[model samples]
Target: MLTINVAFLLAVIVLVRLRRRTEARSRSDERFTVVIVLALGVLIAPTPVGEGIFDLLGQLASGITGASR
Candidate 1:
């Protein structure tokens, strides 16, 4: 029996799609990529890795705001 993780599959797809030349992608292709990436985000958002990313981004945002003030 083979078990595949969907999030892992989507991440691979996103990477492959992004590696293509920008000029090679039509508008619809680009939109499809965006949808895939968004789906990947939703899949990742509840995991510990996602929470860590959120914390890191929050720290960076606060640091920028603090510097500006």
Candidate 2:
């Protein structure tokens, strides 16, 4: 569990640094970044419009884990 947590933390840090570098080169009117963040936020969080997405992901994950046996 400790190793898994450390790995997850490292992964998050690396991803954040990479994303920051990527965003640093973009202009203020970055519609692509805005849209991508909005879509990702909506997908990961619960809202009326996001409920279906969350449900689908949950079902998919469940199916994948269930099939691993």
**What is the lDDT of every predicted structure here?**
0.95, 0.60
TM-score of each: 0.94, 0.39
Error of 1 at 64 (Å): 0.9
Error of 1 at 34 (Å): 0.5
Query: How do the residues 1-69 of candidate 1 rate in per-residue lDDT, one tens digit apiece?
Result: 999989999999999999999999999999999999999999999999989999999999999999999
What lDDT is obtained when candidate 1 is compared to the true structure?
A: 0.95
Off by over 4 Å in 1: none
Report the C-alpha lDDT of model 2 over 1-69, residue by residue, as the tens digit: 334443345445545644665546556535655655555564446656568777888999999999998
RMSD of 1: 0.8
Candidate 2 residues lying further than 4 Å off, grouped into runs, are 1-44
